[model samples]
Target chain A: MVRYKAVIAYDGTHFNGFQKQPNGRTVQQEVEKTLQKMNNGEPVTIFGSGRTDAGVHALGQVIHFDYPQERPLERMRFALDTQTPEDIAVSSVEIAADDFHARYHVVEKTYHFKVQIEKPRSPFRRFYASYFPYPLDLNLIRQALPDLLGTHDFTSFCATGGAIEDKVRTIYQADLVVNEAGTELTFIFRGNGFLYKMIRILVGTLLKIGNGRIPADSIPEILAAKDRNLAGPTAHPEGLYLAEVKYK
Target chain B: MVRYKAVIAYDGTHFNGFQKQPNGRTVQQEVEKTLQKMNNGEPVTIFGSGRTDAGVHALGQVIHFDYPQERPLERMRFALDTQTPEDIAVSSVEIAADDFHARYHVVEKTYHFKVQIEKPRSPFRRFYASYFPYPLDLNLIRQALPDLLGTHDFTSFCATGGAIEDKVRTIYQADLVVNEAGTELTFIFRGNGFLYKMIRILVGTLLKIGNGRIPADSIPEILAAKDRNLAGPTAHPEGLYLAEVKYK
Candidate 1:
């Protein structure tokens, strides 16, 4: 068998999420179906970089699977495209080392969340951005990024309870950028790893800081508390995008 | 009664067209549905700048309609937003002079057609651009524009038969621009008027010229012949966009 790695981009508006479920279409399910068609009725299980919540998008998601036979990259891509729906586009495909794993070798990941502050927002962007009517103070949020940039227990930022007891994760960057139009604000996070809904919760907390619901200085206190209730509500899923996955 | 003019934008991927008909969901149908709801079930007809074909997007389509009452622009815009689908956006709305007519106004209109030469195209842009695999000679297209730009009897460029016998129109500009990545080519046409399928046919002919199917000098002679068969075929509608409509 030959192992292959692929970079995929998907419009997640209609998808339940990236993982397979008993009901509803998922990105993983679609890819598996394509693989099954190419593998003569044998369904090949594929491994993804990570899970993305429902309504989230991705531009450079990575995945891997083993195939029974080795083929040229172009022919494999053609077979994949012929079966995959238009909502999901496989951006790149290549053969991988037998030991290469899509999830284990990841050294960094980046997620971007877009907030649209424009009033009576464009309908065309309804599925891609979160609409927030109130004006936000950019400087306040900028001032708070340092507190969330280092390694810390992200329990307050993750969904309350899971089997995993450790909520510690290292964040290398927390950046906020406003597009040229000044109508949209993007929050970017790059980290070694992220917990369930962690980035969304951080975004929510930062939005509160920008709107004066909480001051920038309150971030350290929230981080110290390590309680989910201390942070703001999780931001909407539509605005989130898994931008990149890096591995050495 | 108050006359209002609005600038509209829509992703025409799911729309039948701009004109209202007995069947199918058209942009006119959706706008009229909103107006009907606002006007106490008294359906108000709107005059559009022109009809955009099915699967053709518009970023700055203009329309005018009469309403029973004069209210703040904000309220009207809000009401429209509440009823329109996510794929359509009423970007701007304001009161217009009673004498102003969207269709009869004398001004320029700009249409843009995008051709993507990139392989492994993104799924997010599935309906926004047409994918052309062949290498196009941009200089050849640029060399042919001077022959087609300016006042001319454009009978050969338009669809064969129409109600109006006068096929004369003046083109202010026929510009070809390539995106920074060089993967996409955009044909921009600004003119006082365009006949049915005129811009699409022009793009089709230009694509032929760029690909060596026809020589640059053939344009003037084709325009003079007044024969539709002599010109290139009409390009696909998906790549066409009603970029803007202007009136002073």
Candidate 2:
């Protein structure tokens, strides 16, 4: 068997997400179906680096799978791309190392959460950004960003109902980029890994701190408390994007 | 009665068109509905600077109406914004001078047509831009642009079935902007006024010239022909936008 790797972009607005669920179509299921067709009716399974929730987009999502036969990588890419839906584009395909695993070998990953502040909702950004018409105190948000860096237990930021036992994760970088107009806020985060819904919850909590609902110094208490109730609400998935996944 | 002027924006994906007709909802119909509600069931008629075809967006569309009673301008703007659907927004509203007219005494109107070349479809821009998967020779397009300057009979560019006798129109600044990535093209046109689907037809003809389907120098002949049959196919309305309107 030969291992193949592929890079993908998808609009997640109408997708059930990257996982194969019983309810409806998903990014994973679509790719698998394409691969199965290419393999002449044989089944194919793909492993994604991680799963983004419904309505969360991905610009540089990475995945890998095994094929029983080998051919030119470009041909496979073209064949797969032609069959995928218009909302999904498989950008690049390549042969992978014999033991390469998409999820296990990742060294860094980045996610971007976009917030449109005080701007009228744009037809151009409806599915791409989350509109927050309320006032945002950027100064307050800046003051609370540093506490999220470095290795720490992120239980408070994870989904409240998930069964994952380990909650410790390392965040390498977390920063904000405000557009020149000051009407858009982008939360950029790079980390070793993230828990389920961790970035969204973290952004939500930080927004609360900026909005004065929570104190600037309260993040540590929330993290230390290790209680899901201590964190702010999860932000809308529409604004979240799986930007990049790095491996070497 | 107090006359009012307002700047409006809308995503035209699902709208029938900008003009009110006997059947279907239009930008005009929606605005009139909102105005009637505000006027306590009294109907209000508005004059638009011009009409945009179905699936054509607007960023600075202007309209004027009259109210039986006077109230704070800000209150009206807020009320219209809050009551309108998410796809439409009344950006600004104010009292107009007694003689102010939306369709007359206009100094400038700028329309922009966007074409995405060799870029993946974006869910956000699905309704806002047209996609063309072909190679374009920019040099040929630049060579033909000068013919569109100054006042000339634009009968060849207007829709064939329209009965407007005077086809002469003056085009001011017309240019092209390609983003740094070179994956998209924007055609900007500012003129005194536009005939029905004039911009779309011009873009279509220009694209044909650039792609070698038509000769660059043939533009003057096409203009002189003053016949609709001399022009190329009309471009898709999804790519056109009423970018701005100015009156002084």
Summarize candidate 1's per-residue lDDT along A119-196 as a digit string, tens digits.
667655677888887768889999999889888998888897666788899999999999887889899999999999
lDDT tens digits by residue: candidate 2, A1-248: 99999988888988999999999889999999988988899999999999989999998999999999898987888777778887788778999999999999998999999987854566556677887776678888889899999999999899977888889888888999998877678999999999999999998988898888899888788999999999999999999999999998
Candidate 2 residue runs with Cα over 4 Å from true position: A36-43, A67-71, B22-25, B122-124
- Minimum summed lDDT over a 10-residue window in model 2 chain A is located at A118-127
What TM-score does each prediction get for chain A alone?
A: 0.97, 0.95
What are the per-residue Cα lDDT tens digits for candidate 2 across B1-248? 99999999888888888999988779999989989999999999989998888899998899999999888878888898778777788888999898999999688999999988864455445567787777799889888888898898999999977878899999998888886778778999999988999999999999998899999899789989988888988999999989899999
Model 1: residues with Cα > 4 Å off, grouped in runs: none
- Interface C-alpha root-mean-square deviation of candidate 1: 1.8
Could you tell me the TM-score of candidate 1? 0.94
DockQ (Cα-based) per candidate?
0.63, 0.41
* Local distance difference test, each candidate: 0.89, 0.88
What tens digits encode model 1's per-residue C-alpha lDDT throughout B53-72? 89999988999999999999
The most accurate candidate by DockQ is 1
